[model samples]
Target: MSIQVAVNGYGTIGKRVADAVALQPDMELIGVGKTRPNHEAELAIENGYPLYAAIEDRIDLFDEAGLELAGTVEEMVEAADIVVDACPSGIGADNKSLYEAHDTPALYQGGEDADLVDVSFNARGNFDEATGADHVRVVSCNTTGLSRLLAPLQEEYGVEKARVTLVRRGGDPAQTGRGPINDILPNPVSLPSHHGPDVNTIFPDLAIDTLGLKVPATLMHTHSVNVTLESTPDADAVRELLDEQTRTFLIPEGAGIDGAGALKEFAMDRGRPRADIWENCIWSESVSVEGSDLYLFQAIHQESDVVPENVDAIRAVLGTADAAESIERTNGTMEIGF
Candidate 1:
């Protein structure tokens, strides 16, 4: 039998997750919960997903917008084997009790506090940790990118410490109201940004420091990463290792894929859904090592990179598949990597 899944908060991540879940052979997307009857709500309906009202009082709002509601969010939770909380930051914490009342296993997005989940998950890094857990959090897109790179290095050469500079997009393309439209702002204005701490939630003992800046771009978030490893490996060897990872797409030179714009175009050319690139785009030429230091540049599709991880998390939490099995199934079904 397929695991019944409900997605709450059908906005950015929620919508993508719902679609991904529907593609999984072992999962059934029961419905999607939304608080408003926006374009996304309409899209969900168009996509044939049953739409449930997240706010009971807002039920009439969706009805008035010419959309039908399946039921209330609570009812959706009750019917599902698991609920993926794609609600905005802090909202998942509020929904925790509702899921608990129904004894439904819930998976949360990275936006939620790590404490809200029994396990902070990255399928490639810690899939086994989430097995049979009541709640699991798929870490943020940035953390997912970092974890993908760090996991392989840590296992092969042992990471002593990592430093990353994150160039974050001010907002998703649809988020027109968000700013830094013409300026670069030192986000958080704090030393060692929260991202490092967020990564630590998944790998508690790993040492990482991240600095963040919000740029005007809305397309993708690029990362400049440096890791001090316990053992020095040749740059070519490092590239070979990263290439072997299923979710890492090493961008070779002469491919003419220079930036996020080109990468998006490439995805579009490949007929990807919403031109989504589910893998980490690492610059092959940028892979460098000096003594014990390893450095590289990678771009993360903030909206889509986490999509596959969410799929894998479902399998992990359900104990339906091991990490490799889940990742293979997800990547193959979704056409994740190039």
Candidate 2:
């Protein structure tokens, strides 16, 4: 029997998770919960996904929109084996009670506080940490990218310390309300952004510091990564190692993929769904080692990177598969590699 999955929140991440879950051979997308009957809800229905009214009062609104809901969100949760809470920011924390009421495990996004769950998950960094947990949070986009890159480094050549400068997209392409429409600002303007501590949630002992900048573009997030390794390895070796990682897509030299815009274009040309690039696009030429210091530039597609992680977290919470098996299946099922 397939694992029955329910997605609560049919927005950016939620919709993507639902689509991914639908593609998983061992998982069944029971239904998706939506608070509004906006375009996404319509898209869900058009895609043949069963939609549920997330807010009881909003059922009338959905009806007004000429949309049919299978049931209430509570009813969907009750029937689900696992729920992916992709609600915005603090909303997931608020929905915890509902999931708990039915003894259904939930996976939350990074927007919530660290204490919201005992585990902040990245399939590459800490899939085992989420095994059988009641609530698991897939870390945020930048954190997810960092974790994916750092995991292999931490394993192959012990990371003495990691420092990253995140050139973040001010908003997702569809988030027209979000801004800095013409300016770049130091988001938080503080040293060691929350990402370092967030990373600690996964690799507790690893030392990492992150800085953030919000740029005007909505294409993707670019990371200027510097890590001090315990041992020195040539760039080629590091490239070869990262190349082996299923989720990290190393951009080869002279691929004409100069930046995020071109990368998005490349993804579109490859016929990627929603122009999503789930892998961390590392500049293969940027993989450099100066003695024990290594530096690289990588672009992260914030919108889709965590889609696979959420899928893996479902299996982890159920203890259904080990990290390797689950990751391989997810990558294969989703066609994750470049």
Candidate 3:
């Protein structure tokens, strides 16, 4: 049976999810829900996806904008086999009762309170934890990057403890309300950033600490990470281990691979609009290991890295694909090497 999926809050994440589901043969995009009747609504309708209003009272927004409403959001929830809520952070949680009321499963994004869901997911790590779970929240972008990198290292080298300093963008590029606009916003400076605990949700047993500093850049988030391993492995061996992830790339020494900008250009030159999601560019030049400590600098395409993870979460929910299957399929379509 083809899985009927509906995307609620069809903005950045929702739009990507809708497109990804439409591409999967095992899934059918039955409908898409948007807060207002905007260009996304027209695009959804043009693509033949039935459009549902996000808010019941805002049904008039669609009508006023001349978009034909498919039905109420409640109706879409009842109709969908799975729902992806891409609404803002708090909204997804607030809407959870509706999904449960309809006996439908939902996949949530990073922003929601992680404890609200039965599982927190990053297809590579904690994927099995997501299986058979009713509600799953994808970890934050920085957390996703950290988990993906750490899991492999721990499996192969045994991690003792790890610390990460995150240089996060002030806001996503599409976002207007965010910025220090040419200023460096000191991290919580006093309190611990949420990432360390956020990672604990995925690895309940691992000892990890994270600090964050916000920057005015909207391109991507960069991390300076240090890991103390139980046993030390040479730099080359560590690089090889990380590359096994398929989504991770070790930028060559001579390549002018600077920051997120070059990484994006690399993906575009190869014809990928949202390449950063899958191609986590961990600088080969930045990789170094001494004694029992390992260090590296990596850049994550914040807006896009989670896109593929979202796709993977849908597959996990429907039991259509597993980690191995998804990794193989995505590797075939994406050029993840540097």
How does model 1 score by TM-score?
A: 0.98
Which ten residues in a row are the worst by lDDT in model 3?
329-338
| Candidate 1 ranges beyond 4 A from true positions | none
The backbone clash count of each candidate, in order, is 0, 0, 1
Model 2 lDDT per residue over 1-338, tens place:
99999999999999999999999999999999999999999999999999999889889999999999999999999999999999999999999999999999999999999899978899999898898899899999889999999999999999999999999999998889998878889987978789999999999999999999998999999999999999999999999999999999999899998999999999999999999999999999889999899999999998999999999999998999999999999999999998
Residues 44-123 of candidate 1: C-alpha lDDT, one tens digit per residue: 99999999998888888998999988999999999999999999999999999999999999999898888888999998
For candidate 3, lDDT tens digit of each residue in 1-338? 87888889888778776877777766788898888877878988888889998788998878888899989889999999889899988999999999999999998989999888999998888777777778999887888888889889989999999988999988888788987777787788865689989888888888888888999888889999999999989999998898777778888889997888887788878877555455567998788998999999999887767766777787787677788887565455443454
User: Once superposed on the true structure, which residue ranges of model 2 sit more than 4 Å away at CA?
Assistant: none
Q: RMSD in angstroms, all models?
A: 0.9, 0.8, 1.8
Q: What is the lDDT of candidate 3?
A: 0.83
**For model 1, which pairs clash?**
none
TM-score of each: 0.98, 0.99, 0.94
Each prediction's whole-model lDDT (CA): 0.94, 0.94, 0.83
